[model samples]
Target: MSPRPPRRLPLGTATSIGAAVLAFTAITVAGLGSFGAFSGLTSARLAMLAAPEAVEVEATLARVGITAETLAAAGCSSGDATNVGADALAHLDTTNWNALVSADGDVRDAQAEVDRLGKLVRAGQADQEDLTAYATAKSTLATETSTRDGLLDALYDAAVADLTSGETTLLETMHGNSDRPVPLQYTVSDRTDAQWTSLRNALANIKTSGMCGEDPDTACTTLVTNCNAETEVATAASNLDSNLAGVTSALHTALGQE
Candidate 1:
């Protein structure tokens, strides 16, 4: 005779069977005389499972603010871009850069809430409400991170533009010359000779280093140093002109030609 087909339990019957198994487990624990120990072990196991996730979440939240701050600092320091010139500085909005400060504070608060919820979960005292709150805080942190990243992108672009314009202006001033003829008698003094040499050396260094070409931030710094050198060159040139004019005037006065 063929065996009768095996019967499948109905939903209600299945639920009863599950309950019986749980009850048997409880009975076995009670017989062991250490049910409390078993419960503690189960809670500890749950906490161990949840701890790593909580730590990872906290680390992610921390990075959101740190990355924003680092980008903002890089943008602001790109080359004294704010003070170089009105047209150049106008390209950037320095005020909005402070947004990271508030965003970081909000992220820290969210992370603290997550930690509290994580503790409750570890202790086996958390309800659905605690988990739900943790999820909400995570969502808030994500939003803050997105906002911060967007602001940083805009600020970085503006800073680069400002630095580029400033670099162009510095280069023009260094290379361009006056069209008027200078007197042959207006020779440079020993001090002027040294100043001219220094300026030439500064320009040479800038050319070899490729200032404002490859890395704008580094180029901006080189430009500042060169600007000071250029000033010295201008002063020396002006002194030579003045000395020449004095000599011409003295010759004309002696000849009674004036």
Candidate 2:
């Protein structure tokens, strides 16, 4: 069997900084929680196909649950005050279990959303690269048309000026032609260009919004999971591995791997 062309990977989401201007903005990225916006013939199959992403989401959700528990226990009360300073420790309690639930819901929803997006991709609804290319092509076409038109208009004006001039140069005879080339032989269809740009831009916007299907959910969950696991495992194993030497040292070291 011949080798097939390597498939292109999905474009990852851009990191949107929560800046002064975009503080209230919700920045979602495709592959958020990595569930990949569930869409396909079978939800199970879609999930299976995207299992890597799902595992990622699962790990994240579990971690988020842990963090919520941690914060709640640590007594970080929540409110607008969390935005304050050293005193913000009180806000830790503010994160409701519902917040964790909501995060879970987002992670779960990503599977469905990504599947939907995938189906759309298959059906040719909104392709990111296609939209990008379309926009580029439209821009190029517009610029080229304008430049070509300008050149042609200059050609026209120059042709007229040269032909009408008193200079004895019969430029037409040099090319062995009887008449001059037609100047201003160009076309500019505003409707066509506008339509193309509008379509491309619409697709670009769709592509941009759909980009963050489950990535955020996945990221939050993963951070919680890994950090919590690290904390717990370290706390537990450290007690077990006390004063390692010859025979026990290797076993203790292997336990550290866990």
- Give me the candidate number with maximum lDDT: 1
Question: After aligning candidate 2 to the native by TM-score, how far in Å is the CA of 247 from where it should be?
Answer: 25
Question: Which window of 10 residues has the lowest lDDT sum in candidate 2?
Answer: 182-191
lDDT of 1 by residue, 125-229 (tens): 989988888788778767765665555444334333444443333222221221112211111112244544554555555565685465334544564465445
Per-residue accuracy of model 2 over 1-258 as CA lDDT, tens digit each: 122111111122101111211222112222333554533233222222211221222222122121112222222223211211112122212232223223323434544555555565668886787556555555554544444334323322322231222111221111111111211001001124554344345444444556956233444445334433554334323322332222132222222211
Per-candidate Cα lDDT values, in order, are: 0.39, 0.29
| Maximum-TM-score candidate | 1
Q: How well does model 2 score by local distance difference test?
A: 0.29
| Collision count of model 1 | 0
Residue 147's lDDT in candidate 1: 67
Clash pairs detected, candidate 1: none
TM-score of 1: 0.29
